[model samples]
Target: MTQPQDPQRSWPRFQTRKPRILLLTSQFFLLGEIRAACERLGVEHVLLDLQAKEMGLDDFVRTILGALTTFRPDFVLTVNHLGVDREGVLLQILEALDLPLASWFVDNPHLILPAYPRTHADKTLLFTWDADNIEPLRDMGYPNAEWLPLGTDVHRFAPGASGRPDWDADVSFVGNSMVAKVLGRYKAAAPGDELAAKIREIADAFGPADEPSAARFMLGRFPELRDAFLELESPARMLAFETLLTWQSTLDYRLDCVKRLLPFRPMIVGDKGWKDLLAEEENWRLHPEVSYYDELPGLYPRSKVNFNCTSLQMKGAVNQRVFDVPACGAFLITDRRRQMDRLFEPGSEVVTYADPEQIPELVERYLADPAARKAVAEAAQKRVLAEHTYDHRLEALMRTMRLTFEPAAQS
Candidate 1:
């Protein structure tokens, strides 16, 4: 079995010319950022839009093959195996052709990647946004798994972009309230009343801890529930249960945070699910979901402070908002994640709250001191421009590919 090259060794200039990359485009938000990075780095790329639901599986595979032959791309890239068929035909085809496949996972890979059969192809490289996931992925027999944190497209999400007055607010949050959707599915697929009760009990016991620890606590408290959960026998059923638990945790945290900031009348921008959560709260304004490209860039800059409450799905990792909000030159107050300390200087570049109780004090402090807020926002924006742009991420990705596979290909 092959291993990646030593980090100390100087990487060879693996590409003599601009490498043609075949981008398997999907509905994922990061697709545009990836494409932008390719363009910025002068990589010739073609997009085979896999998000077109109209295309059948056979047609999708044929179209990919057709694009590959016509474009003669040096590598194929996709977000979380979006273009790959359930039968693993795409991996088989790529393996037969000896073409390299790169799949970057921005979401929880464990929940989705396992569902995609045949992920162990030798020519495939798996990139995850979380450092915690690297070991698990490697444990799953993927030797090429690597840690590649998410990046923001600075060009798109930059400061001074024209923003509407109506969009401006003191504190703003942009995300969905996944409670209804997740719980609805969980209830529909629940095995039995006894099992459902046990699950609820576990959820109630779950605190502000990481997923792995919470899982252990649940199993420790009621060992029988572990077998009951496992006995469901359907991966989808397991996924639904896990997802509901995470969302329920998030729903509780988000509501608590927003309720604390209700006096300030923080703006909530996302889905109608929030309406169900905050039906009587007229002080807190709710807006329809904004487009990432069109609205978020402008809105971030306009708001004094952007509150980033990460989904419960991500434990150690910060969400896209952490990078995007700062790139837009906005002050952000986010919940502290273990990984955030490495990403930004807390209190200087980015502000954070350890718990809901601390949120109101932090918000009040920042809201009262405009100079301090501006200074921090500017510092964060500078940091993002210098280090956290998509171009930097893509360059690192290319370097990894070159180091790992280029030497073997050349030999």
Candidate 2:
């Protein structure tokens, strides 16, 4: 998790006991993993429902306070700042109560955090999946930003039999085509004709570049976008524009990378967008999206090779598939990222493509040699179990939190 490769670095620990955490629950997938991690570590937790968007202010406040009183938590945990509202209601309550908040971000923070208030930046510890986000988050007023990369619930993704024989394929890639997502965000932003044209040109240029944040990359490459940026007026509008471009660039980039799979006749398990993108292409099989917790575990084992191309926002970081596919004891062929060397041993533990052109060759070679794929999958699973489990990540999070916010009780 870019958690340092050296053995000599001093690490923190909970001095008194494992702290109770009040979990702000959502339908987000990571909450389940975090809860499992807490259970594994013997940490106490209680949930506060934040799933309803239309919940009144009275209910929101009452629910939060009730949880705090009952749970008596040492900290409050959230995913992607879900309960930490942009209007600062949650932030106000937490700061008033002196509860430290831990928000683990798995998405592009540039597109998410700008909407949230920064009242308790110091107390709101940010654990980002992307290491590239650390400095940017720090600049964005979260001084306590840290990197805690994605990991798998090994038991959930463990190697098992594939119940469906039809799942067996030379290659399979499970991900959104981003066609609807890009278009949705773009329409929501609703830029004027001239601004929309400028935005399109910027997204077109940004897709192929090796950059992290779309806003920074756009302004750095073309200063003129800054004027169009200011024309958006509201902070929310600016955020919407940046988010739309990010998804648009990702759609373009991912399509180019995934197109390489066409000749291999890959099985694409995703939304209708795949059909929208590759209409009537007879080469590949396009199956509707599968449930991550249930179907993916089975699908990975049957497929000879699993392909992954990350979102453009994560320029130098690995995504969940890099961890999950291996944990399933299946071979994955992913695009190379800067932080990859920190996670896997590259050629031995994992196979990577520095260019999309290399994908077909890698897929062909790996598929032809089952023994080689098996060896690499075994190696990757071993590494994942050892250093990249949810438990390991929670251990690191607890250690860091204690060092920064919690203090040991003196006898």
Candidate 3:
């Protein structure tokens, strides 16, 4: 591969004009949505034409250098730190070019950020969808970490057309079953009985708590995991254990929540793992996963109550469904999250359950009361249009980035 050397690239210039953005391309759905938002806001931008995975420094530098010459972005943006190599090659290249990288972490930053051994506080800006993550990220060596919660693409997810007959239900939940996720990680780690027990204990404890991390929880509650974890014998294995347990915990929590919905015969759309989770039960309808762009928007409106259960990895963060379903003008009955109060007014704009036990009753109430459901759904749609669209988020991010970084550029 030919490499570009000593490239003369323009640094971040947060000037009077709308700052041009160089959107890092990835396999993620968010990247496409961000591109649409950029177009909606009439922001000048370019998507780097390159796959981020398994990329070497030479190819990365060359591609970014090629884009910089043309796009000349004030900042390079990507979600969940896409295009960022674990070895820090991308960070080093960007830092050398004096280009600031704004990474929005939609997933758990704890699981993702630790893999980056090389990062610069000044050259990188971290935004998290979880408000609870802001302080923790600041503690994790990123001083300028900001809260940027996920928002719906109002134009795409808004209420309009009728959904497919097959997709219609009293309640619907669109998400991965986490069955394969937990199993794959379990097989990869192959922990011994003692370590596996440690995992089980941590996961059981982790699933119910407000804390997002079992590792952080273990420091205070369980001491024996340290010795048991040493048996794994590699940092990769340890990280695998962390990931495995998190998924396992989520699967445990989700399975329980979904089981409660079995009485309602909820239409579940996601990976085939759901069949495995609901193998014995014949009540619920499970469909293969649908595309976010093609089907989910239509599917959300068909359900009187769109069920939501957050992942254990996200302790306080509201999942995408909290925004998507409501934005579609579909009523939602979600498990209560700590940040629900800020984004939504539970019991009115959106319905929330404090526990799994409360789910069935909430579902029954909302499903029975069509007028209440419509009112709540309409209220939620209004709120989403006014505040939680990608338009609002991108505009806010543009203003915040300029206010936060423009002075630094001039300095």
Cα lDDT of model 3 by residue, 1-411, tens digit: 444334354453876478899988555548888889999889999987467466666767777677876767888888888766667766766766677788888899887787776466676788898888888888878878888899988888977855798987988888899988888888877888987767667888888877777677765677766777778887677777888989989988998999999898888889999887788999988788888887888998888888999998888889898999888888888888888888877778988888899988888888889999999999988899999988888888877788777867447
Where model 1 places Cα greater than 4 Å from the true spot, the runs are 1-18, 54-58, 204-207, 212-221, 280-282, 408-411
Deviation (Å) of 352 in candidate 1? 0.8
Q: Per-residue lDDT for 122-184 in model 1, tens only?
A: 678888888777887777778788888888988988887878888989988888887676668
Per-prediction TM-score to the true structure, in the order listed:
0.89, 0.93, 0.94
Q: Give candidate 2's whole-model lDDT.
A: 0.82
Q: Give Cα distance to truth, residue 281, candidate 1, Å.
A: 3.7
Candidate 2 per-residue lDDT over residues 276-307, each given as its tens digit? 78885778998878888878889898888999
Q: Per TM-score, what order, best first? A: 3, 2, 1
Residue 350 displacement (Å), model 1:
0.9
User: Residue 37, candidate 3: how far off, in angstroms?
Assistant: 0.8
Give the Cα RMSD of candidate 2.
6.6
Q: Judged by TM-score, which candidate is best?
A: 3
Candidate no. 2 TM-score: 0.93
Q: Regarding lDDT, does 2 or 3 come out ahead?
A: 2
